[model samples]
Target: MRRFVIGDIHGGLKGLQQVLNRCNLKEEDKVIFLGDYVDGWSESEKVIDYLITLNGNQNCVFLRGNHDDLLLNYLKTNQFNKEWFQHGGESTIEAYQKVDSKTIQNHIEFLESLQDYYIDEANRLFIHAGFTNLKGVEFEYFKPLFYWDRTLWECALALNLNLNRDSVYYPNRLKLYQEIYIGHTPVTRIGITIPHNIANVWNLDTGAAFKGPLTILDIDSKEFWQSDPLHTLYPNERGRN
Candidate 1:
C-alpha cells in the first residue's frame, strides 16, 4: 500500500487529477489531503462532488483547512462574505451557486466534519498551519491556523506573550513535532530545507492555485511527485466562462 499526502488543491481539479494519475494510486493506497480544497479556481463544486464520491473509501482522509472553515461558515450563516471574497472565495461562491441546494448542504457537512489536525501512530502530524505551542489545548484558534505563519508563532512563543501556549520554546529553533507535514504557505517548490536552527517540517503547498507545481508527498518513503498547474488551466476571464 502506498501512503501519500497531497497539498492544497484550491479548486485546481485538473492539477489534482494529474497528480493522482502521476502517483498511480490504487485501492490499497492511503491518501491524505492537507486542506484548502476549495477557492482560487472556478471548480470548487466539482472538487466537492469528487470528494463525495470518495466517501466510505478507507484510502482517503480529508482534514479541515481555513478556507474550508470559511466555506462552512458561509453555508450556515450566509455571512462568510468578507473572508471568502478576500481569499478567492468569490469563485467558490459562484461554483456553489451553480450546484443544487441539497448538494451544497452535503458539501457543507463534509467540510464541517473535518478535523483541525491529524496525528499518526508514526509520530508524524499534518495540519494546514502550525500551532502556537499552546499547552493542554485540545484545539487551535481559527485565524492563525489559516493565516498567521511560523515567524509570528515563533515570536509569540519567544516573548512568552501567549499565556495559552503550552510547548517549550527552543531559542532560534524549530522542532515542535516529530515530523510535521503542512500546507497553507505557498512555495516555489517542495521545500525540504531543514537547517540546524530551522524547523523539521515539510511544506508541500506548490501553489496549485497560482503558478507553481502541485505536489504530493509519499509518507513512508518520503518521495515526492509534482505536476504543473499552468498548462492545464485556461486564462482567467473575470469569473465568466
Candidate 2:
C-alpha cells in the first residue's frame, strides 16, 4: 500500500477532489492531511463533509492546523474570534452558519479528533507545521509549535550542503524521525512555487492558501500530485488575502 501526504487545503474542495482522484487511493493506501482544511475559501463545510466521507472508506490521518484550532475554540465558546475572522475565516464562519447545529457539532468533533503530529514506522514525521523541544515521541509539553513553527524549515533551508555532518548544530533537532513532512508556511514564501526539500524535510504547502496549487506527496517515492492553481480553481477570489 502506498502512503500519500497532502498539504494545507485551505478550503479548496475542488482541488482536494482533484488530488484525490488523481491519486486513485486504494483501500489499503493511507492519506495523511497536514491540515488547514478550512478557512480561505467559501466551501469550508463542504470540505469537511468530503473528508468525513473519505474517512469512512480510507485510512486517513488528519493533523490539526492553527486555523483549525481557532475554529474549534470558537465552537466550544460560541464567541466570534476576531483573529479567526481576520485569517479568511469569515468564509468559514459563513459556511458553518449555513449548516444545521447538529452538523456543526459533528464537524467540531471531527476537528477535535485531529492529531498534532504523526510518526510512521519508516521514521517519517508528518506535522502541520514544525516540531520544537520535543525530546521524544512523547513530548512532555504540548504546544501549537506542531502547527505553527517555521524556524525549523528556515534552518533546514539555510544549511550548507557541503558542511560536514558532524559540524551541524542541533543535529538532533528532529532526531526522532529520519525525515519530516510539513505544511503551514508555504514554500512560495521562499520565492519558489513548488514543494521544497532540504535536509530531508519536505515543505509540501505549495501556497494553496493563496495562489499555488494543492500538493500531495508520496511518502515512499517522494513523487507528487497537485491540483490546478488556486486562482484558476476559484477565479475572482483571492483566498486569505
Candidate 3:
C-alpha cells in the first residue's frame, strides 16, 4: 500500500479534489493530511464535510493545525478570535452561518478527534507543524507546539548540508526520526511551490492557502502530484492574500 502525505487545503476544496484525483488513490493506500483544512476560501464547511466522508472510505490520518483549532474554539464557545478573523477565519464563520446545529456539532467532534502528530511504523513523524522537545514528541511540554511551532523547520533549513547525522553538531531533534513530514509553514515563502526537504524534514505545505497548489507526496517514492494554483481554481476569491 502506498503512503501519501498531503499539504494544507485551506478550504480550497477544488484543489483538494484535483490532487486526490491526480494521485490515483486506492483503498489500500494511506493518506495523511497535514491540516489547516479550513479558513481561506469559501468552502471551509464543505471541506470538513468532504473529509469526514473520505475518512470513512480510506485509511486517512488528520493532524490538527492552528487554524483548525481556532475554528473549533469559535464553534464551541461562539467567541471569535480577532487574530483568527484576520487570518481567513471570516470566511469560515460565514460558511457556517447557514449550517444546522447538528452538522456543526458533528464538525466539532471531527475537529476534536484530530491528532497532534502521528509516527508510522517506519519511524517517520507526521505532524501539522513542528515539535520542540529535544527528547522528541513524546516528551513535548507544550502541546500547542505540535501544531504551532516553526522552529523545527527553521532549524532544519538553517543546518549546513554537509553536516552528517552522525556528527556531534547535528541536531538531536533531526536524529529522533527516520524522517519528519510537516505543513503549516508554507514552502512558498522561500519561493518554491513544491514539497521541500531539508535535512530529514519534508515540508509539504505548498501554500494552497495563498496562491500555490495543494500538494501530495508519496512518502516512499518521493513522487508527488499537485493541483492547479488555488488562485486559478478560485478566481473570484482572494484566498488568504
Candidate 4:
C-alpha cells in the first residue's frame, strides 16, 4: 500500500478532492492529513464530513492543527471565541451553522478523537505542525505542542543542515524518529516547498487556502502531485475573509 502525507487542507474541499483525484487514491493506500481541516474556505463542514466518512472506510489519519484546536474549544463550549473567529474561524462558523447541531457535535467529536501525530510503518513522523519531544511526549498531552512554539525547532534549524538529528524539544541525547512531515507554515505560494525545512522538519503547508496549490507526497516513493485552485473559478468573498 502506498503511504501518503498531505499538507494543511484548511477547509478547501475542492482543493482536497482535486489533489486526491490527481493521486488516484486507492482503498488500500494509507493517507495522513497534516490538519487545519477547517477555516479559510467555504466548505469547512463538508471537509470534515468527507474525512469522517473516509475515516470509517479508509486508512485516513487526521492531525490536529491550530485551527482545529480553536474549533474543538469552540464546539465544547458552544460559544465562539476571538481566536476562533480571527483566524478564518468565522468561515467555519458559517459552515457549521448550515448543518444541524447533532451533525456539528459529531464532527467535533471526530476532530477531537484525531491523533496529534501519526507515525507511518517506516517510522516517518507526521504532525499538523511539528513535534517538541520526539521520545515520550504524545501530541494530545500538550495540544499546542502539535502546532506552535518553535523555540527548540529554531535551534535545530541553526544546527542541522542535512536534516538528521535527535529531538530538539529536550536536551537529552534521544534520537528522534526518521523524518518529520508538517504543515501550518507554508512554502509554495499555492503549495510552497514540498520538503521545506526550517528546523530539521519538512513543512508542506503549500498555502492551498491562499494563492497556492494542494500538495500530496508519496512517502515511500518520494513522488509528488500538486493542484492549483486559482486556475479554477475564483473563490467567494468568504474565502478571502
Best by TM-score: 3
Model 1 over residues 1-241: C-alpha lDDT tens digits? 8889888888877778777888887878888888888888788779878877765654788887777888888878778777569677888887777778888888878887777777777867777766654441134554445333455234422454333334555422233456667777666433532110124466777777666667888888877778765335735623211
Off by over 4 Å in 4: 134-141, 151-175, 188-193, 197-200, 230-234, 238-241
Candidate 3 or 1, higher TM-score: 3
lDDT per residue as tens, model 3, 87-149: 999999999998999999999999999999999999999999999899999999999999999
Candidate 1 wrongly placed segments (more than 4 Å): 134-176, 189-198, 237-241
Query: Ten residues in a row with the worst lDDT in model 3?
Result: 79-88
Candidate 2 regions off by >4 Å? 168-170
lDDT tens digits, residue span 1-241, model 4: 8888888777788888888899999999989888888888778889888999888888988888888888888877878778668778888887776798899789878877878777766667787765555353453456677777453344444554554454454333124556667787666533444556554366677777666777888887768887775225235444533
Q: Residue 46's C-alpha lDDT in candidate 3?
A: 97
Tell me the number of clashing residue pairs for each predicted model: 4, 0, 0, 10
**What does candidate 4 score on TM?**
0.84
lDDT of each: 0.68, 0.85, 0.95, 0.72
Q: Candidate 2: minimum summed lDDT over ten consecutive residues — where?
A: 133-142
TM-score of predicted structure 2: 0.94
Query: What does each candidate score in C-alpha RMSD?
Result: 5.6, 1.5, 0.7, 3.5
Q: Scored by Cα lDDT, where does model 1 land?
A: 0.68
Winner on TM-score (1 vs 4): 4
